[model samples]
Target: MTDEEVTEQVREDAEEQAEDAEAETETEDHLGPTSTKLVAEVATQDANLATELEGHLAQLEADREEARERADELESKLKRKQADFQNYKKRAKKRQEQMKDRATEDLVENLLDVRDNLVRAVEDDHENVESLKEGVEMTLKELDRVFEGENVEAIDPDPGTETDPQRHEVMMQVESDQPEGTVADVYQPGYEMGEKVLRAAQVTVSDGE
Candidate 1:
C-alpha cells in the first residue's frame, strides 16, 4: 500500500531469487561433467561389447564351414577306396580264369601226339602176329613217354604193400599169404598227376590166411 513497504517487499523477493539462481548454478556445475562422462563411458563399453560379439559370430561360422569341408573330403576318399577294391577283385578273378584255361590248352596239345601214334599203329598192316604185337608195344611205350613228360604217374601198388584209401579202391578181400589190410594184387592201374589222384587204383585187399 505504501511506497517504502512495496520497495522493501521487492528487495526481499529479489534476494530470494538470487539465492535460488546461485544454488541451481552450483547443482548444474557439479552434475554436468559427471553425467557427460558417464554417458561417454557407457557408449564406449557398448561399442566394445558389439565388436566382441561380431568376432565370436565370425569364428563360429568359420568353424562350421571347416567341419563341413572335412566331412566331404572323408566321404570322397571312402568312395574312391571302394571303387579301387572292386576293380582289384575283378582283375584277380579274370587272371585266375585265364591261367586255368591256358593250363588246359597246354594239356590237350601234349595229348594230340599220343593219339596220332595210336591211330597210325592201328591203320598199318603187318604180315605176322609178332609184328603186330611189336607195333602195339611200341605205341604203348610212346604213350608211357607222354605220361612221363606230363608228370602223370601210374598208381600200381605192389602186392603185400599197404592199401591206401586215398589212391586205392579195394575190389574184394581175398585170402592170401600177404598180411591183412594190405594190397593182395592190383586189378586195374590208375593214374595220378603230382599230389592229385586222377583215378583210384582198383585192387584186392588180403584176408588173413
Candidate 2:
C-alpha cells in the first residue's frame, strides 16, 4: 500500500477505538454505578419512612394517655360531686328532724305551766264548792290560752250535732229526740292540733227517735 493510504486507515482505526471506549464507559455508569446509587437512595427513603412512622406512633400513644387521664379526672369529679350531694341530703334530713323535735319539746314545755296551775287549783283550800269550781274554771281558761297560742283547739261537739267518726268516739248508744247517728252528749272533749286529732271526743250517740 502507499504511505497516504496507510495514514488514512490508521486514522479510521483510532476513531473506532475511541467510540468503543466511550460506549464501555457509558455502560459502566448506567448498569453498575447508577444502579447501586438508586438502591442506596431507595434504602435511605425506606429508613426515613420507618422513622416517621415511629414518631407518629409515639404521638398517638401520648394522645391516648392524655385522653385516659382526662377521663379519670372527670370520673373523680363525678364521684366527689355525688358524695357532696349525699352529704347535703343527710345534713338536711338531720336538720329537719331536729327542728321537728325542738317544736315538740317547746310545745310540751309550754303545757307544763298549765299543769302547774291545775295542780295549785286542786291543792288550795276553798270556802265553798262554787269557789273551787271558779278556781278550776280560771285554770281551764289559762289552759285554753296556752292551747290557742300553740294552734291547738278543743273538740267539744254540741249535743244534737252530727257524730263524726274521725273526731268523735261513741261511748254508748242512747234514745234521744235527735236524729239517728247524732251526738246525744259529749262525755269528754277532745284536743287537736291543726287537722290532727290528739284525742277523739267521747260522746253518746243517739238512736232513732
Candidate 3:
C-alpha cells in the first residue's frame, strides 16, 4: 500500500481504456470504407446492365425497320405485276377487235367485183335483152351461192302463218279472216346470217275484223 504501487495500478487502468477505444475506432474505419466500396461496385454493375438493355433495344428497333422495308418492297412488286396483267388484258381485247375488223374488210373487198357486175347489168340501157337477162340471172345465182356459203337464209313466211316482228318488216295491213298479226303476203325476202339479221323481210299483215 505504498504511493508507487497505487500510481502503477492507475497507469495500467488508463492503458486498458486506451486500447479498447483504439480497437473500436479501427473497427468503424474498416466497416465504413468497405461498405462504401461495396455500394459503388453494385451501382457500377447496375449501370452495365442498363447499357446492355439499351443495346438490345436498339437492335430490336433496327430489326423492325428492316422488316418494314422488306414488306414495302414486296407490296411494290405485287402492284407492278398487277399493273402489267391489266395492260396485257387491255392489249388482248384490242387485238381481238382489230382482227374482227380486218376480217370484215377482207369480206367487203372480195364482194366488190360481184357488186359492180350486178350494177352494170341492172342499168337496163343495153339492147340485148336475152343476154342481159341471162347475165342478171347468173349474177343472182352467184349472190345466192355466196349468201348460202355465209349461212345467210331467206325468210319466206307462208299464208296464214303467225307473223313475227323480228323477221318481218310490215309493208301493208290487210283485213282478212286470219288471226291478228298473221302474215298475209310476203313482198320482199329477209336474209339472216347465223344469229344475225342481214335484212328484214317485207310482209303484209292480216288482222281479223
Q: What is the Cα-based lDDT of residue 202 in candidate 1?
A: 99
Model 1, 151-189: lDDT tens per residue?
999999999999899999999999999999899999999
lDDT of 3 by residue, 24-110 (tens): 999999999999999999999999999999999999999999999999999999999999999999999999999999978867775
Compute each candidate's TM-score over C-alphas: 0.67, 0.61, 0.59
Clash pairs, model 2 backbone: none
* Backbone clashes in model 3, listed as residue pairs: none
Residue 131 lDDT (model 3): 82
Candidate 3 has an lDDT of 0.87
Cα lDDT of all candidates, in order? Answer: 0.93, 0.92, 0.87
Q: Per-residue alpha-carbon lDDT of model 2 for 51-93, expressed as tens digits?
A: 9999999999999999999999999999999999999999999
User: Which candidate achieves the best TM-score against the true structure?
Assistant: 1
Q: Is candidate 1 or candidate 3 better by TM-score?
A: 1
Residue range with the least summed lDDT across 10 consecutive positions in model 3? 142-151
Candidate 1 has an lDDT of: 0.93
